[model samples]
Target: MTSVHDGEATALGMAMEQSAGTVMIRAYVAPEQMGDWTIRVTAIEAQVEHATPGLQSYQLATDVYAEQQQARTWTVTLAIPRVLVAGKAVQLFNVVVGELPRLGFLTRFRLDALALPEDFGPGPGFGAAGIRQRLHRPHGPLLCRAMRPAVGVGTDTMVRLNRDVLNAGYHLVKDDEVQVFADNRAFRQHVEAMVAARDEAQAHSGERKGYLANLICEADELAERWDIVKTLGVDGVPMSPVLQGFSTLSMWRASGKCRSLPTTPSATC
Candidate 1:
């Protein structure tokens, strides 16, 4: 049964419970429309409760300080059932904020915070420790460089840029997100060239140098791109999970095909 929490403290406690995921949303309402907002909130609550299965509870709270300062801040805390997400990124997003914008009465809303059950997705496939281990650096900062001149550069130029950076003692070098792959042939060639440059740098420096291929492409091309990079032995990949969609990234990480390769998430989010 769905329940409504009365206070932020209580809502926070519910948020930490193992059985559910919690999200805190902030909404702004005009002073003239307070009454209308109240009515809308009640209606939206009922609608959400009915439409969202595994919705355990929710709460609406006013920020007293913000109200005094005329900021009009109101917060909503939602406790959703854990089973609904099941370690899937898309499902987690859907259950939390997918239908929010269309619910009306909230011209301005922001997701302030989110708390997931401890066992979210398969965590990071190769996190910081894994990267450090692969690079043979137990501590200290690892220098990484992005192959720039974001666009309009040919494969040879990119290869030269990567080779220079890797040779300059940078631990990792990756393609800029904006770099275009005109076709599969072009992309394969780019990867091959970059990997060869990385190997050469590693050989000369007597240290491991990593190359991360940017895998931002058409949805249909993701699998092929992954196969190419994996087969060619690139150290890692730079991906835009936000642009690719969380589900695609999650699927790839959980697939175990690239378990040994570290993934660097691009700054698209």
Candidate 2:
């Protein structure tokens, strides 16, 4: 059974308890801001039961506040009842703070892990089985390469670099964290250049792909950046979960109903 502590406005250091059969849950949520906040806490099973000879358990949780608030926080607790530990191996959950849904992946179980879900885009390039089904190259691990551009590089310079990256057989790329500000390099120029490079590579060797550009704009002017990027056309944009807050990014991704998106880590989001 799934236990969801769904709510709108919340406060700090609030605790709750829940039980499913013999399994028990103790959730503590300490909200950091006003406006809307969403938090989730779940207990999962740990594998290697026979070797460990005990129940393995862990919890996943996060909190989101408004943009004006700067940052938000929360905590979660899961109590095991000796029936069946929540999980045996990895515990996965699709947590949604407002509209942005992030896949929470748990590896090593400790007291807790930061549930601050970063935007990996609206969703994966392909879902679990979907990636394997489409790319047909999913059995092995994947590598990620970030395009850390020179802070002052002009748009044209960055575009040429995109071409070089695509030529080097790098499967994926994303813009650096400091690459957004009132169009110093011009988002339009960057998108057009990268999209064209992506097309050219496909035209010859038939390797069709591109990179996710970091679109850093002021909260007051994010819409303008989105519109310009859409008009120019690119695969996706990178939003930071830490700096912008989760709800802001959630709404941004929601605005693009039919387009693809990716996100990076930051302070708020």
Candidate 3:
């Protein structure tokens, strides 16, 4: 939890020490294009400079080629001004590897590492401890389930599934990422039905159970969907941040609506 002042001081100190903010990027240059890698690096530097204002300096590390290895790779490390990315997740990502893939010089580009001065992103609304507290499970595994048959099912079928799994001791259940509001049954009706089923199961079992509605919709509908979940007292939500964009998750976390409702990010890859 680095404070803003501390981050600022650290950034200033790094600049004075000629290091700046530490952000490392790694990419594999095509073997045939190795000779022109410097030009690519120059292009990258120019792009980074344009993208990151107030960036103090950057350096490209020595190229590494293993003996008898065909693949050649370069590591680029730089220190950016902390203010540029402080508390900004999307900006941080953009500054690091936004358009680097579009450079068309590297065979493969990867973000190897990142060092943030402060708690840069909208962190988890309810971390592990909070989740445990909410679920009333102080120890042991908190079992979770994803509703199957993501599509082609009515709200009644989904509700029955929720009730059955929750009654059988599952701590949490969520909608699959493929389940969208529009393609499936009415979003509000489906969510409300599932929530009701969850409540009934919890009351019968005398244990806390959670329901996470899939809230992956268009950008304009995100807030509205979130509001529906919150208002209906759905325990949490499952979202595909990569598909929806990381900023969507950041916005949700920052909106103050996620204080009690937990979010699970569905895997994209």
Candidate 4:
């Protein structure tokens, strides 16, 4: 998939200099608006007879930009997995701006592999046993949450629910994906109330809890709401995988705008 890296932690480009395999695809996203850039890459000429998760027809593209004080053009080419066929020896590819990431976006016909930036983080330090050993809570069922849409429940109700949920011993409560509109009491309002409840509950029970409000707004409004949530000092917020899109999440994780982990929730594509 060809995606734009708005200088975030997850936007990476790798270009091999005669097998360079590594030079990040540089983007020039304005700090104020880390916009999504549709990339143009390779695609399939025919459907494969047999394919798995990674072996499928695709058209990828990414826009490359000149870096600061640099004078070279950057590009990337991906080696097609030995599964799908393009009906020809080679194909042309380039970026095609569309309403969404699309199959027809590959028009430049260039080789694969762009020097995209890589995101880094601490790897899993402890397996299940290790985590259990560290926490010393190995004798109970693993905790999980049931996610529900955050719509219909106005801000006041959500605030009350957040409080009640924490008081009832649930460790995590988040706004569902369907809760991003500002007309029915904005997300900021709920976040403020939720934070207060979390603080109160933690003080009373000496147990830490969180309210992950969903950040499912349009890309234009994403960072703004994110800033509001972060400024309020809330512990967490949720993001819809479909609304803002993964490129946005990648950029979010790439930059620390949403903390170490602004939770990513995906609507199945």
What's the count of clashing pairs in each model shown?
0, 16, 1, 41
lDDT (Cα, tens digit) per residue for candidate 1, span 1-269: 12232234323333333222223234644444332212111111222222222332222355642233211223555656556566787877766666544332233345667777656775555567888999999898999898888788777887788888888879999887888887878889989999999998899899988988888888988889888998999777767767887776667656775453324465210
- How many clashes would you count in candidate 1? 0
Candidate 1, residue 215: lDDT:
82
Per-model TM-score, in order, reads 0.69, 0.48, 0.67, 0.47
Q: Which candidate leads in TM-score?
A: 1
Worst 10 residues of 2 by lDDT: 8-17
C-alpha displacement of 239 in model 3, angstroms?
Answer: 2.0
The alpha-carbon lDDT assigned to residue 181 of candidate 4 equals 66
| Tens digit per residue, CA lDDT, model 4, 1-269 | 23222212111222111122322445743433321222223332322232222312243333333232211122333342222222211111112112122223221222344332233231222345553453345666434243443566566676666667767777666666665566324656777777787677667666666556666677677667778777887545556544565355445544645333323354211
Task: For candidate 3, give the lDDT.
Answer: 0.62
RMSD of each: 12.3, 14.8, 13.5, 14.8
Candidate 2 versus truth, CA RMSD in Å, comes to 14.8
Q: CA shift at 168, candidate 4, in angstroms?
A: 1.8
Tally clashing residue pairs in candidate 4: 41
Candidate lDDT scores, in order, read 0.64, 0.43, 0.62, 0.44
Kindly list the per-residue Cα lDDT of model 2 for residues 46-141, writing each as its tens digit.
222222212222223445212123212223343232222122111122121211111122111123443323432344333445533433345664
